[model samples]
Target chain A: MTADVRDVWTYLADTPLLGLTATLIAWDAASWIWRRARMTPLLNPVLLAIVMIVIFLSATGIDYRRYFAGAQFIHFLLGPATVALAIPLYRQIHALRRSALAVTIALAFGSVTAAASAVGIAWALGASRSTILSLAPKSATTPIAMGIAKEIGGLPSLTAVLVLLTGIVGATMGPWLLAKLKVADPRAQGLALGVASHGIGTARALQSGEVAGAFSGLAMGLNGLATAILVPLLVRWLLN
Target chain B: MLSYITVLLGCQLAGETIVRLLGIPIPGPVVGMVVLFLLLAIRGGVPEGLDKVGRALLLNLSLLFVPAGVGVMVYLQRIAKEWLPISAALVIGTLITIAVTGLAMSALVKGRRQ
Candidate 1:
């Protein structure tokens, strides 16, 4: 019995498929929980999935590098997936065109406010400079947040965690926050969710309606651009 | 399908190139997204294969984060040690971001209406 168990462990460790299997299981478990809970944001699929994978790997004494080695195919697809966001944005081009000025201004103000308040509050609360940097771009999508973190001397790994947490929080509390403020328009809800939360919020917005999804998509794209330009420039200005 | 793969690869390459040349602090995919946006804006539509590839990619987006999520293992100690500070920052920062951005966007839209 012990020999069989050891063999199984060795097989899992040797093949990348074990990591992929873990990924699928975690995602499915998260989806099941979300469905049972009526799509509560706190039961966010990504957060739940990550928790599941972490617990599994830690328990089995498997290292992350081995898991990632088998899972690089999935990671490689993120590039295309991000680029695909433009298609939805393209479909909503007319609406985006009409709201060009509004989107631009909202993005500018929102991006600055998002980055500044995070760094300021973190610093005020006595976080290290690296922690402040990690938190600065938490509102943006994962990739951009990671880049900003690296540029400003934060730990990329920490920023990734912060990014995931930001998404989960935004997805979970976003609707409630909007409702409390009496912001009922789907477009407004979607845009707010996307700008503040990024892809995860947009996923939640998709459940509302196509219009909401469209606006959310627009917000996501514009926020990415706004933060991309403004975060580094602002950091440079502030630090210098 | 092949065409979609080509365009996807092409755009990704172009995006990486632009980022390196411009010294943009953003990721390559983000820059590719911007480039794709421009191309669509100029051409007035996404090429056919591009749409299919994009849809496929988006549907499976969650899976892509698996590797990164696993990387969390590397920071277990940091997270354990700094749980309070990290959680505080995330919770507080998210609330502020939601409140300020939500209000600011609502006001901006309302101002436009007025």
Candidate 2:
């Protein structure tokens, strides 16, 4: 039985189907659990699915590169999805116009604060420079964060993982924390979540309402742009 | 759907070109997004087909990250070695970021109200 199962696994793994199928299955299973949990923020479907897939791959001894070959299909959606953010932003033109200046200010302040504090904390904790650089872009969306990390001497792969963790944490705890802070405005809530967490937090913000989702998308994009420009200059000035 | 996608990819390509030409460090897609947003604002509305396609993409946005997130497996050794600082920075930094951005924006937004 063991030998037969091993043969079956090898056949599947040899094709491009394994990673693609595993990702869908893992997310489907995660969504099931998330639904079972009544969509609790703590069981964020992305985080749950990542944990599930990581464990399966580790247990099966499938190389991460091999799995990524198939999984990259879904990954292609990020570009289009990011571009798609324009739709929601377009939809919220009236409200966005009202809060435009405020959003800009918040994004600038928030972006600098998040990156500086993370780099500062990591530096104080004795993390290596590479690790600190990797941590600096954690609040931006994954691609931008990875790109900035590479430009700044950080390992892109390490930054990728840190970015995911940052997003997951932001999505999970943001709303609860905001409520505690008496932050009642959706624009502020969504903008904060986006600046701090990027796409994953924007996903969570979408669940709140169109207004929040729109602003979150705005913040996510603006923060990505800001972080790209700001982190390097800040690092040069402050760290050097 | 296809034309709408083309427009998006086209903008992304333009963004990449602009970034490379100008030596800007931001990701291509983000500039792609800004370009698309500006075009739509000038047009005064999202086209129905593009709106539908874009909405579908955003609705399922989280799925796109799973592949990258799986790369965590490759860093198990590093994570194991530095879990303390890594975890501390993530949790503490995230909370502070959320608090600062939210409060600062709220304060500014409220200032606008008064």
Candidate 3:
């Protein structure tokens, strides 16, 4: 019986199924808890899932690389899902056009502020140069942020983690902060979330309403562009 | 659903090709989003099947980040070394960015209306 159980473990480890199953199970369990907890932002499903998976991997003596070998299947879908952002964006095309100028101004400021503030605070707090660079693009989506971090002399992997943390922070605290500030407009609120948090914030915005979701999507995309352009320039001026 | 997936992946492929060719700084998927948006605009309507697929994908969007988020464990040592600065910057910077952007956008929109 012991030999058979070890054999089964070895077989599962050799394939992607274990990693895939773990990811799904962790997310489902996290989501269930989130829902049961009254959907509080404090209990963010993604954050919960990550914590659970990390604990699981650590306990099992499994490394992230092995887990990612299976999780990559889900990760690859991020690309197509990003492309699908067009659907909600298209649904709100008219509204987008109507607020083009407002979006442009808001995005310009938000993008610059997002990168600058993160970098500034980190620098003042005595983080290293590469760390500062990685944190600079935290507001952009993961792929774009990772790319920018590489271009600007930072660890891409570290940047990816910072971007994730930024998203969680933004998604969890952003709506409440906005409400406190009396930024009651859905478009504005969504745009802020996207600019500050990227896709995760956009996910939170989607729960608010379609209008907020659409604008959040728009803000996320534009913030990527603006941050990509601005961060390099800011790096040159601030770092060099 | 398959066709919708095809269109999305195709656009992303084209976008990746374009970015590589032009050395564009933006990610390919974002450009693919633009291409998809344009295509939908030209068609003047979203097909029901495509809409369903898109919604399903977006609905589960947060789940997609799970893999990457879990990968944070790999950087545990680096993060632990800079935990204070990192945490402060993430929390404070994000809140300030949200406030600045939200306030600016709302004010601008209201000004435009006036």
Candidate 4:
């Protein structure tokens, strides 16, 4: 019976369908719970889904690579989804223009602070150089963050995890912090979430309203651009 | 839906091509986003189908990151070893960024009004 079960597990694991199916099931289950819980920030669907999938993989003895083989289908949508961000961003064109200077200045300050503070705090706390580099791009979206990490002599995989954690942290803690700060403007709220948290934060911002979501998407894209250009230069100066 | 997907994929393809040719540091999808944004600006509005597809994609954006998030397992040992700096940087750094950006954007935009 044990041998038969092992054979079945191995056979099923090889198909891409299982990985894809597992990912969708996990996300749906997590989303359902998140809604049931009244959409608390602590119960972020992405975080919950990731935790569930991680546990499932570990218990089943499946490796990341094999799981990714199936999950890659969903992952592939990230590209198109990113492009889709342009629609919302474009819709907010008038608002974007009205606050162009504010957006530019705030984005500059926010982007610089994100990298500098992370790198500074990590280094001060005795993290190694590579780890510091990985932390520098944590605010960018995952793919760009991972790329920046690779270029700056950090562990790309470590950076990927760190990036995800940053998104989760931002999405979870961001609302409370904004509320505490009395940031009531949707544009400001969205920009903050996008700049600090990237896509996941934008996902949270969208739940608030379209105006917030559009700005969040805009901020996410702009920050990705800023961080990609800024971090490599910052790393050179800081590390050297 | 299919056409909208095609446009998105095409834009991404063009973005990848541009990045490859120019050897720029930006991600392909990001460039694609820019391209699509430009296209929409020229077109003067989002098509109904495009909006539907884009919203659908964005609606499930969080789900897309699950695969990459699970990659965290590969670095559990390293994370355990370096938990201090990692946790501090992510949590504190993220919160600080959010606070600064939110405050600055709000104040600046409000200041512009006056």
Candidate 5:
């Protein structure tokens, strides 16, 4: 029985469908549970999904790289999904125009602060150079953040992980922080979420409404651009 | 859906070319996003097809990060050693950013009115 079970496991692992199926199932289960929990920030679906999948892979003795081969289909969608950000951003044009100057200035300021603070605090706390570099680009979406991390002498994989963690944590904690700060405007809250957390945060922002979603989308793009341009130079200057 | 996907891919392809030729540090899709944004601004409205696809993608955005997020396991050792700094930076850093950006946006926009 044990021998047969091992053989079956090996056979399943060799196929390409496991990663895709596992990801979908994990996300579904996570989402269902999170919703059942009343969408509590503590059990964010993304975070829950990640934890579930991580354990499944370890228990199954499946290599992550192998899992990625099947899962890359979902990952491939990130490209088009990223391009899609412009839609909501464009939807908010009128709102954007009213506070364009404020938004732009705040984008620059927040982008700088996001990167600088992550790097500064980590480094001061005794993280290695590579670790500091990885932390620097945590606010942007994974692809852009990973690109910036690679350009700035960081571990791109590490940056990818940090970016997700940042997004999950930001999305989870952001609303509470905003409420505490008396940020009454949904649009402003969305901007804060996007500038600070990227896609996952934007996902959370969208739950509030279109205006919030739009601002979050706009903030995501502008923050990505600002970090892409500024972090390389900033990392170079700071590390040297 | 196919045609709309093409528009996005076309922009991304063009953006990739520009980035390669110009040595720009930003990601190609982002530059493509800017191009798409400018084009939409000129058009004065989003095409229904693209909007449909894009919104669908946005609605399920977090679903796509699962694969990459799992890669965290690969660094278990490093993360374990540096857990303190990593956790502190991510948690504290994110809270600070949220507050600063939110307050700044609210104050600046309101200040403009007064």
Candidate 6:
């Protein structure tokens, strides 16, 4: 009995596949729950997946590095998947073209407000400068947010967390809030999802309809560019 | 099916090539998307299988984020030490984002009417 148990432990420890298995299992489980909950934003798949992965890792005595080795395949897909968002965006080109000015303005305003308010509010709350810097770019996509965070002296890892949380909160409350405010225009819905939630929210928007998906994609791209430019400049000005 | 796969792969390749050649800082996937869009636009419509593949890809989109989220473990200590700041930033940033975006979009739409 002892030998059998020891062999299982050794296998789990040595094999990188364990982590991938764990991640998929957790993701599927979370999906089931979220779907059962009828896709409530509060019970978002990303949030639930993270929770499940954490609990599974801890309980199984597996370290994250080992798990990540097997899971990087999925990670590698993120870049390509993000690029694929353009298909839906392209399909809605007519709608996007019509709202070009609106989207451009929204991205500019949304990107600036997202960074400034985060820094200002954090500073007011007595957080350290580094914390404020990291928080400044939370609403942008991960890569841009990380770059901004690093440039402004904030922790990239912490900024990553903030990014995920931002996505979740955006995906969760966005549609509900939009409906409540009687914002029926798909363009508006798409723009809100993209600017606030980034990629994940865009994914959610895609499910809503083609027009919403395209606008969200536009928001994702423009917001990313705006933050990439504005965040560094803002931080430079603030620090100086 | 084969044609769809070919186009998808071609788009991915073209995307990477453009990014590398142009030295663009944007994500490769985003670039790939741009190329795919241009191709579709020029052709005047998405090819049949493209939609199916795109749908499959988007549907399982959340799965792709799993690995990155797990990467968060490396920053466990940093997260704990800066929990307050992180949380404050996320919550407040979200509110500001929603408000600014919603208002700006609403105003833009409204302005167009006038």
* TM-score of the first chain alone, every candidate: 0.87, 0.83, 0.84, 0.84, 0.86, 0.81
Better candidate by lDDT, 3 or 6: 3
Per-residue accuracy of model 5 over B2-60 as CA lDDT, tens digit each? 89989988878877788889987777777777788888989999999998888788789
True contacts kept of 3: 0.77
Chain B TM-score (model 1 vs. true structure): 0.92
lDDT of 4 at B21: 96
Can you list the residue pairs that collide in candidate 5?
Answer: none
Candidate 5 C-alpha error for residue A60, in Å: 1.6
Candidate 5 clashes: the total is 0
Q: Write the residue-wise lDDT of candidate 3 on B45-65 in tens digits.
A: 889988988888888987887
> To one decimal place, how large is model 1's interface RMSD in Å?
2.0
Residue-level error in angstroms, candidate 6, position A174: 4.6
Per-residue lDDT value at B78 in model 2: 79
> Compared with the true structure, what per-residue lDDT tens digits does model 2 show for residues A1-240?
999998997899877799999999999999999899987667777778989999998888889899999998998877767777767766765557877888888888899888988988888888877788889989988877876887788877688778878988898889999999999999899998999999779889999998788888889877887898898888778667
Better of 1 and 6 by DockQ: 1
- Alpha-carbon RMSD of each model: 2.3, 2.7, 2.6, 2.6, 2.4, 3.8
**lDDT per residue (tens digit) for residues B1-114 in model 4:** 899999999999998899889987666887888899989888888999999999998877778878877887887887888889989999999999999999999999899899
Task: Please list the C-alpha lDDT of all candidates, in the order they appear.
Answer: 0.77, 0.85, 0.86, 0.87, 0.85, 0.75
Question: Docking category for candidate 2?
Answer: medium
lDDT of 6 by residue, A1-240 (tens): 999999998887768787778788889899999889977667877778888887778887778778888888777665555555666667655556877888888778888888888888777767777777777778777755665566567776567667878888788778888787777778888888899889878878988998788788888767865776687778778878
lDDT winner between 2 and 3, please give it: 3
Name the weakest run of 10 consecutive residues (lDDT summed) in model 4 chain B: B23-32
Q: Model 1, B18-97: lDDT tens per residue?
A: 88999777778778887888888889877777787788888777667666766777878877776766777777777666
TM for every model, in the order presented, reads: 0.90, 0.88, 0.89, 0.89, 0.90, 0.81
Please give the distance, in angstroms, between residue B104's alpha carbon in candidate 2 and its true position after superposition.
2.0
lDDT tens readout by residue for model 3, A48-117: 9989999999997888898899999998888888788778767765667978889999999899889989
Using lDDT as the measure, the top candidate is: 4
CA shift of A85, model 4, Å: 1.5
What is the docking quality class of candidate 6?
acceptable
Angstrom error of the Cα, residue A33, model 3: value is 0.7
